[model samples]
Target: MSQSDADAIDEGVLADARAEASVAPVPKGSLWRDRNFLTMWSGQALSQFGAQITELAIPVLAVLLLDATEFEVGVLTAANVAAFLLIGLPAGAWIDRMRKRHVMIWADGVRALALATLPLLWWAGALQMWHVFAVALVMGIATVFFDVSYQSIIPSLVRPGQIAEANGKLQSTYELANIAGPGLGGWLIGVLTAPFAILATVGTYLASLVALMLTRDHEERRAPEDHAPILREIGEGLRFVFTERLLRRIVGYTATGNFFNTLATTLLPIFLLRDLGLSPASMGLIFSLGAIGGFVGAIATPHIVRRIGEARAIPISAIAMSVGAALLPVAALVPALAFPLLVAQSFTASFTVLLYNITQVTFRQRITPPRLLGRMNASVRFVVWGVMPLAALLSGALGTWFGVVPTLWIAAGGELLACLFVVLAPFWTMRELPDAHSASR
Candidate 1:
């Protein structure tokens, strides 16, 4: 299609979306009554809970059960996120051609099947470190598609005005899962062992699949002949993100934050388990407690945006994130107070990150032309999440070379430095984002 033709299609899509929003029967601020949204939200709730179990179980299995070295654990962490770097750009183009709900359903199915193998292998007494890495890699690949579709589909399920609220609700559910899933998974791990704990994730993912299958959302699918070459489509996404000045700065801040955050996260389990001598249950409790901030942050995001203005909230949250990252090394320094300090770090990081995410994500979804939503999200993730595996591997090497505590100190410094991306930008002077009508074409 010609450039003018593509722009015309984009305008038509946005007009249709506005028309749909105007006629929506549900009252404003009432997503509860939107059955289609509720259906998708329910599926995500189950999926997030299942993911939390795997997040805890897999690392625990590698660390405690297989007695893997710190480098091995880092490699395992890298495997879990490497797909974003590998296929992140192409996945967006693919997702744009299919119904997002269908994409999400398939992703869920892939994850369920992949996780189910862990218990089967363990029961057969054939489970090994490579087996765990392979499963994690597959799950990560599925997750890349699922995550992109999940973000893109929300615009279809709710009115444009409700995007922030929708994202907040979804984020809140994720934090809720963060709070409850680890506690349950850790207890199950202590009892049934880490491999068996993975079975719970398998069950939840299947449940998520059923919920997704029941959801209905408005999606535009391109005919096979209408699709452009994958590389060209990916390039379109990259251009949109890089050329849009507001989005460019936000991506820079987020990509930097994620790099340092993953660096610390890659070794946190080992630090807690080996250095602090915490048991599985205790570690789970700390995670559960720390997630409380995220839960509260999700709930309070709209109010924060309203109070401080959306653009201003970004840098403010970035500043808070730096403070949160700083707490990690302090915990290491004063091991006597390590538990509370670590919990404090989790709380600060989760809360501020949620604040930053809801504000920026809502901005991205609102400003982008409807035709490019999938690619836009994908390009952003490709940059932000792509660095994660590299950071994970670096964390492993750093932890092994300098020890976990000192590595955490380095991670903390990096986190503080990341704030400069947003703090020094124009977002600090603005109060709100551009409306869709006035957004970049």
Candidate 2:
């Protein structure tokens, strides 16, 4: 077909997708009884657990086996998230043009293969820090595709009403993995060679790949259209996000929260380990205990949204997040209160943050056309997660120059300001999400 004909067909598909986004579908059956959704859920559960194991294992491997310096460790961390900045835009356009399930399965398989190579190299006594970095970078790239497709695929799995419930369950599994994965990683490393420990992670990805392959989703095929130039496609996604008032507000809310929340990741360890003189065991316990908040928040979100509406729930959650951020800095002031304070902050922060996550995810899914969903999600992630590496680097500079406590206070203050963005913006006052898909276009 000619380019004009293709564009016209795409525009028709876009119109249909927007209409679908505006209406709630009647429930066919509970997502629980839907075999396909269960299969998809099982895959996600496995993938999340595997990701957690690798997240811890990679850093531990570098520190223990490769004897990587602190600077190198920082670099490894940055490399893991660098793909969001580098590939986030184009990946979205690519995913939207392809089948989401295929993208997810291939991404998983590629990541598994990349990780499996580590053990072979290790067994040969030729493992190096650069190899680890390269693997991490590869994994990050695969993850970008997986994550974008993952969110975009959800509406296909369940009813619109069920999106919040489904998302809550997914978040619960994710948090459960985060709480348990590190401890599991530590055990595997202690019992087996660091290289061999990776086998479990590799196995999980394989399992996830298998599960996804087995699941049958009857996704409505989009019309065949001429592909736009990659950069223009990316710009289209960015323009959608920025032009829509609701999307613009959400983007601002998330970007601000992530940027200022950097101190929690960057400085919390130092404050707990050096300033407070806590054992690693105690610190781990604190985090694990606090992760319960995430589980609680996820479980509680559907109810919160139902009772108060998503608009109210989000601002309330933001307030909780701001308070959590503020408390981290103050925890150092009272040595006697330090441990308890950190634990409280951890729990409250996780719970509230997840509340924000579940609500926003459901809202976005409801308001965005399926065709633009991947691009919209990618645009949000690029702006939000893009700041993370820079924030990490900035956190180090500030912490070293101004001391940990002061830097944390600055982070906390920034978080409070972040809360205000959501509170004052359209997200807070809008009781219901209108058809933002059409509005954006």
Candidate 3:
């Protein structure tokens, strides 16, 4: 087929897919009514909860057990994000060529096996900083594969009208896991030590593996084509995301928000523990409040999106995030307000992030070709997520020079600045879904 013919065919397929997505009536009762979606959702939820346990445990292990300095802890955090920068596009390309379900299953299995080794090494007295670093990098690589494939699979499983609802459900599950996992992890670390506490995460990944295996679905077939070089494929994905006007704006705005958020994430634990002299249990309590906020936001997002429209949702949520980000400095100044500060931060951040995610993801899914979904998702994440490590490093360096409190003020200021991106962009005026249907006509 000629290029124009191929474009026409793609447009036709998208039209049919969008119409089906827009009007497919989902049953109102049990989520399990769609057994495949439920299975996939449940598996991912379980795995996310498990991942959170380790997310807390790893830093705790580094901070409390190994006596890592602020900079070292930041490096450890950066290590976690490094794989997304390095392997993200390639992983996405590979995912586009294979069965997403199988990719998810293998990814889960890899994370489970990687996590399980931590306990083994701890028992053998062979665990070290490098060991933790290695595990973090591997786990990150596995996550890249799982995440890229998972996002691509959702559109195939649900109708278009259901995308926001499905995404809200998924976010709710993740938020619930966040609420439960860290609180539970703090208690586990208090009782069992960080290494042993991480064993729980291993079990969680195993549960996900089993659930994914039980999920029944026909494998999606790929279009026949010659494979391009990995570098060229990666470049194509990057170009598509950057060249597309909507995606470019979203990426720019999201990347701005994420950079500051990541800076805070790298600093928060150190700030709470080192400067404020808060215990792990207390820190966990405060963090759990944020999770509660996330849960509320996630559950409410679909309705909120429907009510206000996706475009308006972005700036509203962005303002909330800005307010939340600015509140971090208050927690530092008035230690008595730490809990309340955390609550505000959690609530606003969760609400804003959910709105941003639902809008951007739905738009991207609508615009990108199905065959390119994995790479496109990964490539965008590569840019958005890739900055995290650099942010961590910058935060750590700033903390080292100015102390944690000053560093946090700077980070919060940076986050507040993110609002400018949205305020200035055309996204501020976009109050509804684009004229996607017109493309078909």
| TM-score of predicted structure 2 | 0.76
Give the alpha carbon lDDT tens digit for every residue of 223-331 in model 1: 8988788888788889999988778988887888788888988997798888888888878888888778876886899998899899899889888887778787787
Cα-based lDDT for every prediction:
0.79, 0.72, 0.72
Best of the candidates, TM-score:
1
Full-model lDDT, candidate 3: 0.72
Instruction: Quote the RMSD, in angstroms, for model 3.
Output: 6.4
For each of the candidates, the C-alpha root-mean-square deviation to the true structure, in angstroms, is 5.9, 7.2, 6.4
Q: Give the per-residue lDDT of model 3 (tens digit) for 157-255.
A: 765656555665775676677688778778888888888888877988888889888887665757757567778877778887887766676677777
Q: After superposition, how far is residue 100 of candidate 2 from its true place, in Å?
A: 3.5
Off-target runs (Cα >4 Å) in candidate 2 are 1-43, 63-70, 117-128, 153-172, 186-196, 213-233, 267-284, 302-313, 331-338, 362-371, 399-406, 423-441
* Candidate with more favorable, higher TM-score: 2 or 3: 3
- TM-score of every candidate relative to the true structure: 0.85, 0.76, 0.83
Q: Write the per-residue lDDT of candidate 2 for residues 186-300, one digit (tens) a residue.
A: 5676677567778778999999999999987667656666676778767777887788776677678778778778644665556665678765456556767777787787679
> Lowest lDDT 10-mer window, candidate 3?
1-10
